[model samples]
Target: MSGLVDKAKNYVAEKVANMEKPEACLSQVDFKGVNRECVTYGAKVSVKNPYNTAIPICEISYVLKSDARVIASGTIPDPGSIRGHETTVLDVPVKVAHSILVSLVKDIARDWDIDYQLDLGLTIDLPVIGNFTIPLSRKGEIKLPTLKDVFHKK
Candidate 1:
């Protein structure tokens, strides 16, 4: 059980990291509302297991930071499942995705040079379902993107 928990945690972390990496930018971003800051991205995941067992539950959390201090925090508990015995990543949750995206947009929007109140929309894409064949096969450690990277313009 301990091993499974650790693997799950690591998996979530990696997914989140990859999703926000600079190189991972969505091919095209559509802005909405009067403010261009308002944007949305969507994601989905599928899972496959050898035994057809229900996908293990995953919990995700979002923490907003500023000046190295936490400004807001939220969590998505066992948002969804990857489906049992399926060999694909499942779409788990969206709230955390939205929170992170909104936080990023809001940060840049607050800049004096940028006059706007951002209302962000987000989508998370679940790529190939990881190989969870072995009890300890899954890795869960991820280096999260800093607030600046998520919100700042390069």
Candidate 2:
């Protein structure tokens, strides 16, 4: 009887391992806007659902790092749901304080941009599969707006 139970567990594990899972990627990160206190950047994430039913997103957590230092981190709860058989795009806003940018002047002066790594966790609830997290990471450089660009009239 114990052997039979062990075999059943192994079968279930194998099935789960072979199941179709959702996939996601960080598409782009760009400067969004600037406010009095901080500059905001938007990170775009594309998620593809493989199941036939819509999956509810549990949470989206993100960390923005530069020079191996965390510059922004936050969690977005219950952002929405991923459509079945289609791709959904989500936007995550990251705010970095003006003071923080000032501290990195040396790096900015060299290339007029900031190099960054964005780490994201996309959690979704799959039927009969519980909650699963799709981890994504992207590295790139974002060009900073020059004084003329900021003050230029549209």
Candidate 3:
């Protein structure tokens, strides 16, 4: 009986390992807004759902870092769902206080840009599979607005 159970477990494990699952990608991150006290950015997350049924997104958690310091991190609760057989784009917003950006003066002073790493976790509920999290990371540089950009008229 124990041997039979072990075979069943092994079979299930193999099937689960071969199962078709959803995939995610971090498409882009760009400046969204800027104010006197804080600078805000939006990360575009593209999730592709292969299942016929829609999968509910539990949350999107993100961390934005610069110069080895975490400038911003937070969660977006109930962020919505990945559409069935379709790709959905979700935006994750991050805001760094001016004080935090100011702390990276050395890095920002070089070439007038900030080198950054953005980490993201996308959690979704899969039928009969519990919750699965797709982890993604992106590294790039963002140029801060120049004085001319701030003062330029559209």
Evaluated with TM-score, which candidate comes out highest? 2
Instruction: Give lDDT tens digits, candidate 2, residues 51-93.
Output: 8888999999999888888888999999999998999999988
What's the CA RMSD of model 3 in angstroms? 2.0
RMSD of 2: 1.8
Candidate models: Cα lDDT each: 0.35, 0.90, 0.88
TM-score of each: 0.28, 0.91, 0.90
| Model 3 CA deviation exceeding 4 Å by range | 147-154
The superposed Cα distance between candidate 3 and the true structure at residue 4, in angstroms, equals 2.4
Question: Which candidate, 2 or 3, has the higher TM-score?
Answer: 2
User: Where does model 1 exceed 4 Å of error?
Assistant: 1-50, 64-72, 87-154
Tens-digit lDDT string for candidate 1 (1-154): 9999999999988986664211111121122112233222222323344344444444434333343444334445555544544554433221223343445554545551212211212222234544222111111111233455356665
Query: Between candidates 1 and 3, which one is better according to lDDT?
Result: 3
Q: Which stretches of candidate 2 lie over 4 Å from their true place?
A: 147-154
Query: lDDT tens digits, residues 13-120, model 3?
Result: 899889999999998888777778888888898899999989999988988988888999999888888889999999898888989878999998878888999999
Estimate candidate 1's alpha-carbon lDDT, on a 0 to 1 scale: 0.35
Candidate 2 — which pairs collide? none
In candidate 2 the C-alpha lDDT for residue 79 amounts to 96
